[model samples]
Target chain A: DAGVTQSPTHLIKTRGQQVTLRCSPKSGHDTVSWYQQALGQGPQFIFQYYEEEERQRGNFPDRFSGHQFPNYSSELNVNALLLGDSALYLCASSTELAAGELFFGEGSRLTVL
Target chain B: AQSVAQPEDQVNVAEGNPLTVKCTYSVSGNPYLFWYVQYPNRGLQFLLKYITGDNLVKGSYGFEAEFNKSQTSFHLKKPSALVSDSALYFCAVSPTLAGGNTGKLIFGQGTTLQVKP
Candidate 1:
């Protein structure tokens, strides 16, 4: 089965600009979560989407938002990007039955200039 | 708030030697602990988890973690290390909500393991 997949594997944006990263969950999975991994650090939870709505969120600001479609794909949008926004954006998928165990995609490397 | 801590930034071991990466967690209620490995340019890969079972949990790539409730620690261990095992290891914890698991994970800073042959 195909694992989690993310788009725009690598991209660059300037300050005050906006960017959107896409994710397709693993086959047969319905939940999608986004994480940010800064240099030399582990991933920080951004938010999680289930049933086409954001069910859980982390410490991120309003500038960061996400959407889950009926097909279980997800998109993470960052508005007014800052230099600190530069990091690896990882997308993970899991089912309600297997909640804690996540399958991650290679991640999209976002570089803010 | 839930959190995870990986005490070591880097660990070096001989290829044939055993290895241990320490992790400690803090949570309000029952904590669902997990271990994940990440290679260069790759996402975190699930290793093992500690749920409501035996203290010892085995996972992919011969990785095993021992959950100590009293100590609030989950340390990943391998009987023998391999050069291929060199990568970044992360410890994460999810709090158990009254309804169910929120599927949210709090991750540690990560520990780099170097297995030299």
Candidate 2:
């Protein structure tokens, strides 16, 4: 009955450094998607993982990558982070294909200082 | 490309007053619309969705959204506003699975709602 869960409620990183955020999808869910939300702005799609492979990606740079574990958990890795990388990284999970109603995690706040 | 617009950056209303947040969408086919809310420094919470069938769809937290095909709009409404209702709202749209676009959603810029006492 647990909802989506994320780790390390917050993080601080510097330029050129790498950061990895974690997420566990809601029970009975198998697909995971990542999104980035900047202050006062809406969330933007990053990428989606299904069947342990990236099914789709957004306009993000190659520096952004993700992995979906066999257990349906996900990790979002951002390499060579820039100041602009500072934002709230949210992970959403859904079970059925093309079903846009997603259950989202609390999200990890990444601060690139 | 699919897109959504929330024209009002902010909407303020007194407690107990009815509230409405405007949204408009653009898509190549039938739209699968959604409304989500975000509290201070939190992730987005699903409020409701409009996929098909009735134009009126009700969701959690006493929220309801009306899907208007002619206007290409999905506006979120609440009969009575609560002080705790203050938050940021986002409208999103995607071509429904039947309409032939992937399930990926395109979201609006977000609107800040302030329900004052």
Candidate 3:
């Protein structure tokens, strides 16, 4: 059984540009959540996707959006990236929307130059 | 509102010694607590969780956490530390599953644990 997987393990972008990070949730999982982990900080919830619709979001602005495909894969898009956007973008998958343990992917390291 | 705090920024311990990473949390109803560890550039890995029942929950990698409801704490512990145990640890809390919070998780600032040889 494969665990959660993420694409573009590392990427570099510049200000004003947009970037999309991909994530494939663990098998048998349906809900996916995205998190942003800045240097020397814990991962912060970005948003959550369930039933192909965004269910909940954190303090992030509108620039940060996400989509959950029918297959339970997810994509996190950050538009007009700023230098502060440089961080590790993590994806976690859970079996349902209720509280439970989450399986995480290695994450995509985004560097907004 | 639900939140968590890791009072220590860093903790140092020698190999073979016991280690503890402190954590405290606040929530409206029943608290769902969790601990995750991160190794350099990697995503957080779930270590253990406290939902109900036992106050002491044992998890992978010889990790165990004692959930104290009165003090509102969930501290991670290991019987014997290993150099490889050095990493960043985070404590998290989730609001009642029945509440509007849904699957949201609020993480602590994170504490760095260094198990020296």
Candidate 4:
């Protein structure tokens, strides 16, 4: 089965610009979550999407938003990007039956200039 | 509040030697601890988890973890180290705090394991 897949494996953006990253969940999975991993640090949860609605969110600002399509794919949008926003963006997928241990994608490396 | 801590930044061990990565968590109520390994430029792979069973749980790639409720620690262990096992290790906790799988995971800083051949 195909694992979780993310688009634009790497992206570059300028400060004050906006970017959108897409993710497709693993086969047979429904829930999609986004995380940010800085150099030498673990992944931090950004938010989760279930049933096409954002169910839970982390301490990110309004600049960070996400959407879950009916097909279980997800998109993470960052507006007014900051240099600190430069990190490896990860998309994880899981099921309601086992919502804890998530399957992650290769991730999108975001570089803000 | 829920948090996870990995005390070691890097762990070095010779081949065939045993290995251990330390982790501890802080959360109210029950904690669902997990161990994941991330190879360079790859996604995180699940190693093992402790839900509500015996303190010891075995997982993929000959990895295991011991959960200590009193200490609030879950340490990953391997009987023998392999050069291929070199990667970044992360520990996470799911706070079963009366929410329906909000899916917010608190992760450790990460431990780099270097298995010398």
The TM-score leader among the candidates is 1
lDDT (10s digit) by residue, model 1, range B61-114: 999999999999999999999999999999999988899777899999999999
True contacts kept of 4: 0.87
Order of all candidates by lDDT, from best down to worst?
1, 4, 3, 2
lDDT of 2 at B38: 88
Q: Measured with DockQ on alpha carbons, how good is candidate 2?
A: 0.66
Per-model chain B TM-scores are 0.97, 0.94, 0.95, 0.95
Model 1 stretches astray by more than 4 angstroms: none
Write down the worst ten-residue block by lDDT for model 4 chain B.
B95-104
Work out the TM-score per prediction: 0.98, 0.95, 0.94, 0.98
- The whole-model C-alpha lDDT of candidate 4 against the native structure comes to 0.92
lDDT of 2 by residue, B8-70 (tens): 999999999999999998886787889999888677898999888999999999999999999
Tell me which of candidates 1 and 4 scores higher on DockQ. 1
Clashing pairs in 3: none
TM-score order, best first, reads 1, 4, 2, 3
Q: Top lDDT: which candidate number?
A: 1
The per-residue C-alpha lDDT of model 3 at residue A50 equals: 89
**Chain A TM-score, structure 4:** 0.98
lDDT of 4 by residue, A14-82 (tens): 999999999999989999999999998899989999899898889899999999999999999999999
- Give Cα-based local distance difference scores for all models: 0.94, 0.90, 0.90, 0.92
- Candidate 1's docking class is high
- Write candidate 4's Cα lDDT for B1-117 as tens digits: 678999999999999999999999998888688999999999999888888879999999999999988999999999999999999999998877665444578999999999999
**What is the C-alpha DockQ of each candidate?**
0.90, 0.66, 0.69, 0.82
